[model samples]
Target: MRAPTTPLRPQPDSLWRAIAAPMSTGAPLARDIDVEVAIIGAGYSGLSAAYALQKRGVECTVLDANPIGWGASGRNGGVVSSKFRLSFPTIASTHGIDVAKRMHRLAHDGVRTVEAFVDEFKLERARFEHTGSLRCAHTERALASICAEADWVRTTLNDTSMSVQSRAEVEHETGSKGFVGGVLSADAGTILPLEYVRGIAAGLNARGVPIYEATPVIDMSREQDGRVLLTAPGGTVRAKQVIVATNAYSNLTEATASYHRELVPFRSAMIATAPLSPELDAQLMVNRRSYTETRRMMKWFRNVDGRMLFGGRDAFGKEGEPTGFDALQRAMVALFPQLKDVPVEFRWSGYVGMTFNALPHVGRSDDATTFCLGYNGAGVAMASLIGQHAAALALGEKPELALLAQDGLRPVPFHALRAPGVRLVAAWYQFLDAVGA
Candidate 1:
């Protein structure tokens, strides 16, 4: 790993950035250019799309307002769990059993996609750990849900890689006794998020796919010649097709205003404690399994390189600064009293794009514009898969998982009031969680 250098715009002072390996922040587009496909955003989705396009021998370039890994891709918790925000049984009941099974397969394929990238690109510093993840229940209702999920995974999905645990088993697995019960999925894992994304950017550059940093697409319009014209601050991009992969930052440009309306952006925060002693580390996170809560207002933690990383919601402070360090520390201490004195060394937050369906979307705005976004806090795997599907859609090819492909997305209702609405929903969820609802 290498020390992070400064970028054009100030980015979150995240622990991932601090320890990420170095990669070039390619120069901004400074002149008119034409390409087969143009991508906006330098995060996982954009870079992955560029890679797919490049592999297919298609001409493409990536544009971002900031440097590579400047968004949620670099800042998010690197849990590579093969599951969505909604459970499989719920999807099975809502959608048909076939569609639910396909969705489940897609989720597993997403994990493989990321693993393949790491292995194919030799991203050793990304530290891809296949230690698996644990989903702990905060309430008995949550425990019941976990049990249902486990049963569904085994019976319906015909997979026995997961096991349900009792409260004593949960306490044994995680050093904390806060959880009632839990389920462990052996397919889940962890990585250094910034390192992984930066490694992807490196691989893309090696493939000759130009990634222009600090180049924002201000406006987009269609040309009479049936091509798409993108107006960037430094130059213009004329492309046969365009891919908008900006996700939560879609609101930054007028070109993606409609895409922004399809998602409710929420700030997610995380804190990291200084490295723990070998004894304490072993005692806290036995087997080094990634841990998460089943509460609506979710919480997650894991030991990364001897440091304890705890995360939850509402981390943004005034003036773009990160808040809730104290609250996060208190929560962490509450979970594991042994960490009461473990000083927090880092605090940061990033925005996640939430869809009304609580699932990702891959679709086209027009015949010439393709987009894939709204990972609902599971972007590490889902974003990569969606990006690949977005590329296939742009190429006029059917995506393997056809359920995700759509003509367009419906806008979130009352989009302007989402901020306050999110606060209210979060408060209600917290209240219900307190009462074990």
Candidate 2:
């Protein structure tokens, strides 16, 4: 196998960025304006909320620090799985069986919403695929737990679309012998994440929503007339309500500094190999299903246009290093030996917002200021749902995801030490993963 000759530079270039067409660089917020709603962050969440609000005849403006799809929405693995970071059993134990079931339904609904968006909007450029997902087990005990979880999903949740696969079956499906067993969810799938977000932006643009790229809201405050004032580099937006959909890239302004304490931004890196040969592609990941392991620091991979895209907890520190790319390449080789010498063409990383509790949070930071974020790396599907719910909340409507609203946003303990604490916790998790705990 040919190894990396030099250290990989930590560049912001991503495979998605190369493949997806550039979105139109809409003008920045050039002048002060008043709208019914102003959205911060032009990612999937912001665009989805804008679409929803447009459909409801609500005027909204979207502001972003960078171009659309420049955040996690464009840099994710694009698995689009309905599962959250925490397991169903853990959710049931913490909340209740009914709440867990509700959450599951909500996640499934979120997946369907993405499907609907792709279909209704004709997002063929997004490479939307209905291929299912495989949750593989790295250990025998984990396989048993996966089996139990599958059973619970079937009986408790009445979800007949999910099934467990034995080691032999999983091996046949994935062409990899590393996993002991797996669970398949037919509802899950994959898409070109950057294309998907850009497609949404296009729809919003068509609907006359002003999306101000490279315009960050430097400050936000309330007016005496119960309106919100958002100050940007070029101008300001005065709106009746505001939604913060910045997710992991949230900047700490006077109005949003408290939100920084509620979530931790953890960097996740990804690597993609050059397009594989037809023979190699047919031998590895022939099913074209998104796959991830059951490890605490898990690995996620999928086949995109005959190329292998793999990602995981490659870097535990704040910044990504060349060692992280080496780790991911090693992981890919371990799973599919036939690609041991495959040339890697892309390496990138992005941050994911993780909350104190493992669940995504959506609520009003204060009256006229609503926020929805903290996906724990499962933002593709849930972000769309949460974003729409956030828009609805801003419009004085009750959001459908009640659990997120009920849980509310609680700042992590010792918010100032989150960076060091996250590193220590990552180290502990890595130790546990290495020890097979």
Best by TM-score: 1
Per-candidate TM-score against the hidden true structure: 0.96, 0.94
RMSD of 2: 5.9
Model 2, C-alpha of 92: deviation from truth (Å): 2.3
Candidate 1: lDDT of 207? Answer: 82
Q: What is the lDDT of candidate 2?
A: 0.83
Q: lDDT of each model, Cα atoms only?
A: 0.86, 0.83
lDDT of 1 at 272: 94
TM-score of decoy 1: 0.96
Per-residue CA lDDT of model 1 for 1-437, tens digit only, reads: 22223237756787887887655557888888999999999999999899889989999999998988888998998999898888888888988788888998998888898899999899899988888889999888888978888998799989887898899988988899899999999888998999998899998888889998888888899999999999877788999999999999898778788899989888888999999988888887787888999878888999888899999875544325646667778888988999988889988888899988888888998899998989999999888878988998999998875356566878999999988888888888878877888
Which stretch of 10 consecutive residues in model 2 shows the poorest summed lDDT?
A: 1-10
